[model samples]
Target: MTATDVLFIDDDAAIRQAIQQTLQLEELTTETFDNAASALKILRPDFQGVVLCDFHMPGINGLDLLKAVQQIDESIPVIILTGQGDIGTAVTAMQLGAYDFIEKPFNQDELIELLKHALEKRHLALENRVLKAQLRIFARPGPRLLGGESPKMKRVLSMLENLVDTSADILLSGETGAGKDAIARYIHETSERSQHNFVAINCGAVPENLIESELFGHEAGAFTGAEKKRIGKFEHANKGTIFLDELESMPLALQVRLLRVLEERKVERLGSNVSIGLDVRIIAATKSDLKSKSERGEFREDLYYRLNVIQIDIPPLRERREDIHLLFHHFALIAAARYGRESIPLNKQQIGLLLQHDWPGNVRELRNRAERYVLMGPVALDEIQSAASVDTPTPQSLSDMVDAFERSMIQNALQMCQGSIKDTMEYLGLARKTLYDKMKKHGLDKAQFKEDADHDGL
Candidate 1:
C-alpha cells in the first residue's frame, strides 16, 4: 500500500471513471472495483489506504462493506459515497464505522481534500501499529529479542507476533548462536501461557541411559538410582510449553516414545502404567537439517515429520547486516546497565568494523562482544577485529576465522552424514573431490565421525 493508494468501489461506470480520473489528476492511485467482493480480496489487516464505496450498490452496499472492512482492521478509513436521498443511510454508516461521507454531485476539490486527510490518517495508523509492536517486543522487563528493522528479521518478528496467541507446535531451525532459545522464550513469555511453566531441555547434553528418566520421570525403585516419584518435563509443562533444544541429537530409540507422547498428548512416568493427561505446546529447535538426518537414518523419519508441522527459520546475523548497529546498541545498553559502566558510543571506524565483520556466531557472539566492550573499553572493539572473519579485520584472525568456520561446517556435515562422503557432499553442496580435499586439508578422518549407536546405548 502506498501513500496514493485508494480502493474505489462504485457500480456506476461514469461515476467510477470520473473519480478515477479526478484521483489520478491529484496523483492518487485509485484501484477501481465495481463490486465490493473483488475489493475485499485485496483488503488486508495492514492495508495502508482509504476506501470509497457507493451506498446503494448491488450485492454489498457501502454500509455492509464498511462493516466488513472494520472486521478486517478497524483502523482503516472507509469513506461512503451517498446521494441526497441516502443522507440518513450515510449517517447510519458513520455510526457503523465509516470515516466520512461524500454527497453525490460533490465538488472535486473537496473530495480530494478529504481523501488527503484520510490517507494521512491511514499512514499514521500503520506507523503507530509498528511502533506499538516494537515497544511490546523490546520493552519487556526481562531479556527480550533484540528487535531490528531489517527485512528478514522483520518477517521473522511478524511471524512470531502471529504465533504468540496461537497454540501451534513450532520447529525452529537455525545455527547454534542464532537466538532460537531467545525466540522460544519470547513466545512463551508473551503468550497466554506466560503464567504457566516453560520447561526447556537440551537433548544432546543429557546422557543416553538417563535421558529417558530425565524426560519421563520415574517412580520409586524404578531404576538403579530411582528413589522417590518424580515428575517429567512434560508433566511439569502441563498447560504450558516445553522447548526441546538440539532436537536432532535425540536418540532414534527414544524418538518412538516421543512421537507417541506428541500424538496422544499424554505422558507416563517410568515403571508406571497409568498415563498422565498432558496439554503442552511443543517448540523444538534444531541446528542440523532434520530432514537430511532422517533420510540418512540418523533420526526417526516419522518423528521428524510429526514435529515439523510449522517451522520458522531464524536468519543468521551476517544475513541481516543492516541490523548490526541497532543490535549493537541494544546489547550495549543492557551490558552497560549490568556492568555499571557508561554506554560509550562507537566511532565511525569501530562501527565500520562491526558492520564489516561476518558474524559466524550470530547474536550470541555480538552480545559477548558488547559485554566485553562495556566491561573494558575501546580495546574491546579490537577483539572484534581479532575475531572477525573478513579481510578488513586483522590478517592473523581473517584466515584463521574463515578456516575455522569452514572446518566446523565440514565436521558437522560429516558427523550428520555419519562419514558418508556422498551424503556429506550432498548436504554441503560440495563436489566429491572438493570434499575430500577439504577433509584432507582440515586433517579430518571419516572414521572419527562414525558412531556406533548400539555401543553408545543411543
Candidate 2:
C-alpha cells in the first residue's frame, strides 16, 4: 500500500482545499477528501499516516469515524477539527480515542506541528509492530532465530517455519558468522526429533587421516590408534540431527561414503560386518557454492544433490540493512543483562556508526560489538567509527531519539516491576492512564515482560 503523511477528511470543499494547500506547502504528503465515507473507504490497518477529520461531517461524523478508524487500527492517530461550538463533542471524541483536536481558525503553525508529531508517532508504531512480530519468533528456548525484517530474512523465517515438522534434509548456504550453525540448531530444536541427540561436526576441522574413522566409528584394531569400538556421528544421532559444517571441505574420498550412508540410511563400522540401520537427518552448511564445487570435481555432485533437498540462503548483514538496528538492540539487551549493566539504548551517533560500517563479520561481528558496548559504553562506538572506513552516521530526528529513549525506559521499568502496571506506574511516576497510553504507544505488552520475568526466575 502507498504511504501518505496525512489522510485529510472534511465535508467543506473550501476547507479541504485550503488545508491541503497548507500541508503541501510544508512538504507533507497528503490525500484530501470532502467526506468521511470516501476517506474511510481508502483507510487501511497498515496505513502509515494519520487521519484529520472534521467533527461535523455530513455522514459518519468525526466520533463515528474515530470508532471506525479504531476498529481498523487504534494505533492510527485521528485528529478532530472542531468548531468552537463543538468543544463538548471534541472532548467526547478525545474520550473515544481521538489523538487530539483543534478548534476552528487554528493557527497554521500549530496545526503543522501537530501533524508532524502524529506522523512521527505513526512511523514508530509501524516499526515497533514489525519488531514485536520478529521478537516472538525468537522468544523460544535455546538459540533464538534472531531473524530480520528484510525480505531475504523474511523468506528464511518462512522456510524455517514450514520445515519445522518435515523430515527433509537441509543445506544452509551463507558466509561465516552469517549464522548457518545457529540456523541448523534452530531447525533441529524446533523439529519433532528435538528429544534425540543433535551432533555437530566441522568437516574441515577434523584431520583428513582420521576423518573417515571419526565419521564411521572404527572397531577395535580397525586402525593403528583404534583401541576400542566407537560409534560414529551418524549412529550417535539416530532419530535426530547431524549438522556437518563446511560440507564442501569434506574430502572427496569421504564424500563417497557419506553419499552411501545418506542413500541407504545405514552405516557400516570400520572392519565390521554389521550394518546399523539409521534414522538421521543431515543438515549441512557451506560458505561456498557446493554445486559449483561439485561441477569442478572438488565436491561430489551426487552428495551435493542429496543434501540440497532444501537450501536456506542467509543474506549478509550489509545486504539487509533495515534489520541491523533491531539485531544490534537485541544483542545489546542480552549483553547488558549478562554484564549486569544498565542497558543503554544506542543514541543517534552510535546507531549511525552501526549502520555506516559494513559488517564484514555479519551478525557475529554485530553481536561482539554489542557486548563490547555494554562493557565499555559509547566509547566502543567511537572506536568502531575510528577503525572502520565508513561514512559518518546520519542521525535520526529528535522525535526518534525521544521515542526510543522513552520506550527503553518504559520497557526496563516493566521488567523491573515484573509487568505489574501499578508498580511500573509508581516507579515512573505516571498516572495509570498515562502509563497505559505510553505502553500502547510503544507496543509494550505487559504479558511478555511478565513471561520474561518468570523465565528469568524473578
Candidate 3:
C-alpha cells in the first residue's frame, strides 16, 4: 500500500508548524505551505493525498483554494480549518466542494479520525481509476484484435471467438512480431476466465539457471538469495490463463516437469513435496515449428502433442497486403490519441512505399512506423521510404508487376498536377471513376500532395 501525504496550508507559521508536528506524531507524511497559492502550485490531478487549509488567509483564502483543488482533481479531499464563530463561512466552504470542516482548537482525536477517512477515500478513488483503465483495454468492441478484411485474419478471428469458452490448451505459431501475444491476450480477455489473472512470461528472456525457479517458484531458502516464499506464474494464473511466449526456448529438462504438471493438473514447488492443484489454461506461442524440432529430437514429441490441442497460425504482414493500410491507420489513430498529436495523412508515394515493403518485422514494425509518423510527422516519410526501398523485392507475378506499375503512374500524375483531381485525370488519360477507384485501392490520399492555393505549384 502506498502512503498518502497530507498537504496543510495556513498563513500563520505557528499554526502550520503545530499541525505538521501533530501529523508527524501520528506517523502521517505531511507538507506545510504558508499560503494557498504555493499549495495550489504543487497539487496535481493524480495527487494521492488530502488537503487542509485555513478558512481565512492573506491571499487566496481556503474557499478559493478548495474550488481550485476541485478543478485539479475532485477526488482529493480538502478539509477546511475555521476559527470560532465562522460556522457560516464553513457552510460556504462545504458548498464549494470542501470535504469537511474543523473549528480552530479542534480535538486531536477528531482531526486524526477525519484525516484517516479522507485518506481511505483518496486511495479507493485512485484504485478505481486504475481498474477502469484496465477494463477499457479489454472491453472495447472491434479493433481489439487489430485485424482487417483479409481472409487470413478473418480465419484467425473466427478461431479465437470459437475458443473463447473452451478450456483447451492452445498453440500459436507465427513469425516474430506477428502479434501472437496479442492473440493470446484476446483469447483470455474474451474467455470465461476474463476476471482472473492473465499471466504472461517470455521463455527465452529468463536465464537458463533461473527459469525453473521463475515458473515453479521456490520455498524460502530453496536456493541462494531466496529469502522468501514466492508464487510462480502457474499459481498466479490459477483459474485463468498463462501465456508462454517463445516456448521453443524452454529447456528440455523443464519440458518434462511441465508435461507432468499438465497431465496431473498440479505443480510441485522447488524444495517442496506438496503438490498444489491448478486450473490454469496454457497458451503457448513460438516462432519455430515444434513438429520439425520434435522430428529432429530437439523437442519432446509427447509434450508437443499435449500443447497442440488447438493451433492458431497468424499470417505475416506481407501475406496480408490489403490489411497494411488499415493497420497503419489504426495504429496512427492510437498514437495520435496517446501523444496528443494529429494523425498525419500519407501521400501517394508514401502509401505505395508502405504496400511494397516486405515488413520483415511484421505488424510490430508497422505500429512503430505509425507512432513515428505521429511524433515526427512528415519527417518520417524519408525514413519509411528508405526502409521500404531496401526491403522491396522484385514482383514474381504479372498481376503484381502491373499493380506496381499502375500505382507508380498514378502517383506520378497526382504529383505532377499538385493533387488536382481534374488535372490528374487528364494527365493520366483515365476516366474520373477509374482514377478515384485506383486511388482508393492503392491507399493514396491526394489531399496530402495539395499545395497551398495561394501558390500555384512548387
Ranking, TM-score, top scorer first: 3, 2, 1
Which residues of candidate 3, in runs, are more than 4 Å off? 1-144, 392-398, 401-458
How much does candidate 3 score in TM-score? 0.60
Provide the TM-score for each candidate, comma-separated: 0.56, 0.58, 0.60
Model 1, stretches more than 4 Å misplaced? 1-143, 387-458
In TM-score terms, candidate 1 sits at 0.56
Rank candidates, lDDT, best first: 3, 2, 1
Assess candidate 3 and give its lDDT. Answer: 0.80
Global lDDT scores for all candidate models? 0.79, 0.79, 0.80
Reference-based lDDT, residue 362, model 1: 81
What are the per-residue Cα lDDT tens digits for candidate 2 across 194-303? 99998889999999998888788989999788899999888899999999999888999999999999889999999898999999899999999988898998889989
Better of 2 and 3 by TM-score: 3
